[model samples]
Target: MSTPQPQTHQQAAPAPNWQSAPGTSYTSPIPITRTHLGHALTSEWTKIKSVRSTMWTLGVFLLLVVGIGLLVAANTDSNDYADVPYTIPAFFGLILGQICLITLGVLVVSSEYGTGMIRTTFTASPQRHRVLTAKLLIFFVVAFVVSAFAIGFVGLITSGMHGGASDNKWGGTVLMGALYVSLLGVLALAVGSMLRHSAGAITAMLGLVLVPAILPAFLMMSESLRTLGEKMTEYNAPNALAKIFELDSENGGGGSQLVLLVGVTAAAIAGAYALLERRDV
Candidate 1:
């Protein structure tokens, strides 16, 4: 061997330790927080409040409720309420205002579908059921609160204008009416979710709210059909609210109307949940 065979040098190979060892767990550098119903509620609240449809719908609701309420109160003499509950005047505005609530309810979910925002909503929160539940809760609460305030304000004004004719039942009647309308709005949301289209859902709800009331009038030609139509008229949305207001013919009373609405709304919500779970975004 050449005496000074160029000093050979060998470097040790690096150990294969960069990979995780067997049975060892790896932690991510990123942090994640668990989401809950509260988050969904917040998201829904923000979405509902930020939309122009909400403003326009609710604005018209307020105008109709307050404007018509005052007008009715101003035109009628307090003595006229001797036989009727003072809260009856609020009915004029609430009947029309309910349309606004229904429109807003449809827009709440249908608008998102129309704009394709639902895809992002599901992407962010894959638990579709939770998202839908949150929407229902938030919308019901908002609708109830706004309606209550409007009805209360109208009742107060009517009472002041006709104190002697006012009845203590005004509170209960107003609360019941508010509940009825809120349920209708919730039903509208469910329909919107099921249809996934704004115009279609709105039309469906309009029919739900209106057709039952009018159909009976035309069906009076047949006795058997008239009976069914009469029942529909008695239990229809407007008549239900009117019963709560103590203005309509007292067939089933407000209690029966509330029960019917609750049943219908519950069924719709269940169907909505089922459809939402099975369908693709």
Candidate 2:
């Protein structure tokens, strides 16, 4: 035959079914449904430790808390300090430590954004809140470890630095400072989750965490600002929390300070989570 005749419409061969293949056409496996908080916590813990900044920031926190405390102790004369109501040097050290806390807090959350690994974290965790919570727990636990040694060593070494102005240190002020840093990490997490930029989040945190402390001095009505300043200072919970640590047991931070910090931290975290849910990942 010169050429095969074209099949008529009725005789046209049936089309092959491409839908069914040797291994059925890939149907994407359903994404894992639930995210376990414990799983997320463990994973986050690993992420924090692996990062270099975590180590460096942590090192600085310990160093300053100890070194400055020691130096302050060695230098200040008891005679001059006796008249001062507050232990200026120790107070100064506490304030300085907050600087380190801010960096440590920022890195804990902001690093994910800086490295673009947060997306991966979200991918694996899927539940944003769970991941965030895990992050908080992990940050706090590590902060606790760091704080234990950092606070204890600083406290003991700086006792002499107190220059006879006695402050037993609050029951948990040292721990509070650590928790504040950790919670600040949570605040950073919220901010970072929203901003997704390390520089911006860190800048925001500096303002959010530090400005209130400095603002008290700059206020126009110094005498009138006593109450207002007290209220505003709580915004910088770390520093306020640090003050609690600087006080003796006779005048510990008491409920008011603790309540103030808890209130502020709760508000910030709540606001952050709400924003996080509404914003694009």
Against the unseen true structure, what C-alpha lDDT does each candidate score? 0.89, 0.64
Best candidate according to lDDT: 1
Per-residue lDDT tens digits for candidate 2, residues 1-281, read 58988987777799987776676666668875655788888898888889888888778776776677667767755564442322234444555665565666666766776777778988887788887777777876777677656655655554545544554433365566555555555566566656667788778877876678778766636777777776675545544554555443344553455566567667777776787677665
Off by over 4 Å in 1: 1-17, 20-29
What are the TM-scores, per candidate, against the unseen true structure?
0.90, 0.70
Residue range 1-281, candidate 1, lDDT tens digits? 55766877999998887878899998889998899999999999999999989889989998999899999999999777876677777889998999999999888899989989999999999999999999999999999999988898988888888765645467887788789888999999999999999999999999988899888888887987888887888888878888888777557457898998899999999999999999998
Ten-residue segment with the worst summed lDDT in candidate 2?
Answer: 81-90
lDDT of 2 at 42: 82
Model 1's TM-score against the true structure: 0.90
Error of model 2, residue 96, in angstroms? 2.0
